[model samples]
Target chain A: MIVGERKPLEEIIESLEGAEKVLVAGCGTCVAICMAGGEKEVGMLASELKMAAKLRDMKIEVSEATAQRQCDKEYLDTLKDDVKGKDVVISMACGIGVQYMALNYEPMRVVPAVNTDFLGANLDVGEWAEYCQSCGDCVLADTGGVCPIARCSKSLLNGPCGGSADGKCEIDPETECAWQLIYDRMKALGRLEKLTEIRPPRSWKTSRDGGPRRLVREDQKA
Target chain B: MKSGSNLEKVFEKGEFALTGECGPPRGADLEVVKEKAKHLVGYVDAVNVTDNQTSIVRMSSIGASKVLIDMGLEPVMQMVCRDRNRIAMQSDIFGAYALGIRNMLCLSGDHQIFGNQQDAKNVFDIDSIQLINVVHTMREEGKILGGDDIDGKPEMFIGAAANPFGDPFDFRPIRLAKKVAAGVDFIQTQCIYNMPKFREYMKRVVDMGLHEKCHIMAGITPLKSLPMAKYMAKKVSGIDVPQEILDRMKGVEKKKRAAEGIKLAIEQIQEVKDIEGVDGVHLMAIEWEKKVPEIVEGAGLHPRPQVS
Candidate 1:
């Protein structure tokens, strides 16, 4: 899931300078699961903004509305009525959702209230860790299903560098060395020989190095 | 002789080689490199110029190598993947070769968090093994990574680092074999304070017959003080300073610790020299260049072998 965290209240408030009427929008998908930009968070942000405005002697009115998923146009269309007459739309969704909302409501400034962190999995209550980098190409099959591109601090394709000690990365004692995990997994599966093969230089073109990416499906196109 | 470098020539002649390291100054001072090279000029075959080691910004390895070359000393210029992409790496290779450098050491480099520039973005576009292959392809095939033919290839005696003390201890030898398969001509290991562990690691390397494929140089650094010994044992990653060595250092008087450190380093050199499959010793007198000659002489490795 796309994990995101709400932007600091001060920065969000500063972004709304000179706004008389504001709409605090939320998404019910990934952000909601992460407890960041769900309907409940939207209500809390709206009340806080109203209190801040009152304390500063500013004449401002804040409204709240949430969509099932802001990335989908059909779901965002439901908030059309709530968005009307608002000077600004504060999107409490991931970066993609903010951009989608801005595109759907052309000429309306849709500001992001959350910072999209990464494609990750929630390990526990309020604990999330990145799992993939969306690098168009994936090599999980060869690495015992461990994603070195995302897990390794250096994104090393070959075995662990000299920095692996006690199964921890040299960078931090808390972070587990990704290659060590791969080694352990491969050894458990009796596939240790697979690691002997040297991986060639990665074609970073498939990654962000190739620039902004787009997926085109001719079969699904109208 | 691969690159006809003095180091390669020494190895080709089946002579035990000796290399030294010289870290460029934090500022742009060629004099510092020359001063460091003076201590190692006649005492070693080739000098390794570190590239922003520990991620702290310093004069580039290539720039410092050119300084050594100007002083009539051969330099094994070190290149790290942490700072440059393929294009920049290749460009520097060409430039370094043009300036008379013939030896190169490829490394993944220390993380930037360990350096002064904690906020800097690292460019590990290629790891050390891939970097070794890149240099090999550029030299052997006369083609850049993109498959474009170059007018003149950088004929370098390529080298890579090995850390026998790194974790998943059983896999350390396998990593060395992978480097050998990647076309590395020589291997300089991380500093060895744990002789028993290093001997076991070498036994595995010898069993795999990787020793026949590339020259293996044991890394040696003198512990300047008890504090320095403790730092390496605890703080520095991948470096294993055995408890016995620390206890030995602790037994020495504070004023005599430096002497004890050099004596221990000399003892290590003598033991490593007798180890089968060990090719040489890379003396890294980090910031203590003046003591290199004494350490080399104390180890009975003085009057280095001469090879044309």
Candidate 2:
């Protein structure tokens, strides 16, 4: 689950000021669970946009439609027909959804309705927070479930730095020290001695540094 | 001689007025809104354009009001603070007033979590009370939201929604009093089906002496079908159609339910109007505008006084 927040309505309306036929598109996957981009949200944005347009004395035609998963081509193909006639497509999906629509519908102007923040899960209903950076590395097995890449201000792989203050990080007093959490978890597992092992420098080239990444499954392909 | 101030005169005089509600189109089709406008213009004193009613996005209330204005109808543009903060909402008030929309209905709007676009963020810069106060601030204090003085202020006839049918009934009058205290000139309540409950609620307002301060309009929407009645009873918050009304609607065939709804609505209007406390009635036909005149006439309300 990825957690994110919505942008202000005025900012979004400003983007679509010149557009007459606006399509408020949404995604029903992660964004739906997070209460960000879903059918209900798309309908609301469409209505708000219409209200704003009315005040401006401009005739804005707002249409609402939601896809299953905006990051997938199959889901985006569903909107192939509607996308052509729209002057602007306000995507309420995550950044992936917004870019996916752009990749497929090259002609239509795609705008992000939600500011995609991080890959995290809901703390509870109507609340969400970041948890993962998707660095393409799985060190959770060595460090308990906490991801230092996201929890630690500095993505230190081996152990906590000198800045750990009373089990909390110095930069963010509100955040628990990721190293402290890791050390506690390792101690519980009788692996506290693992901290003494020095770690090699990180190789970030395997992640987004390489460029857009892909995963191929020859067995699943037709 | 000025029409705008002349319109204000009637409202300030405590005269009874009629208002109707219209939801804008979901798509860019103007014809659909125009068709609804056809049934509203000239029949009612003004039409209330919903701003994202039920938190579902559709065409803008402002655009729909313009269409209503083009059709020679006065419009009360509904403004909800759900999507906008203080800056935008204040600016919109001035902008709408400048564009000739003089009436407004302030609301906190539905939470975004309930709408079709669930991922949409919410900016609750202010609640309904603050919004009403802002309008009053502009009208009385003659200043912008930022406290900058203006030579002239925006004069808006503001209204708010009341829920008589909501449970823990004690809170209703208190909420109404709060809105009144915030400078709300009038109030349009949620749907009123059970006159006894509404009458009982009004007694509280009378006890508080609020009846003399604000013009109260009873909201009435005819139950088009048994399913619609059931839906309203179960799904729609702040609305409760009595079992008797549902039973009355249940016996009717589906084809004739619309006519039955109009008759039932007329009956409601007749009951609510005869009550001494209710100043007027706000009819929310809900995509049934054509039946408004029928309901109005059925209730024996003439557009103007008859010659002796």
- A-chain TM-score of every model: 0.98, 0.92
Determine which window of 10 residues in candidate 1 chain B has minimal summed lDDT: B29-38
Cα deviation of B178 in candidate 2 (Å)? 0.8
| Runs off by more than 4 Å, candidate 2 | A1-222, B1-14, B304-308
Inter-residue clash pairs, candidate 1: none
lDDT of 2 by residue, B69-137 (tens): 778777888998768767788877777777778788887676565568777766544567667778877
- Classified by CAPRI criteria, candidate 1 counts as high
TM-score of 2: 0.58
TM-score of chain B of each: 0.98, 0.93
Off by over 4 Å in 1: none
Residue A1 lDDT (model 2): 72
The candidate maximizing DockQ is 1
Give the Å error, residue B136, model 1. Answer: 1.2
Cα misplacement distance, residue A167 of candidate 1 (Å): 0.9
State, as a TM-score between 0 and 1, how close model 1 is to the true structure: 0.98
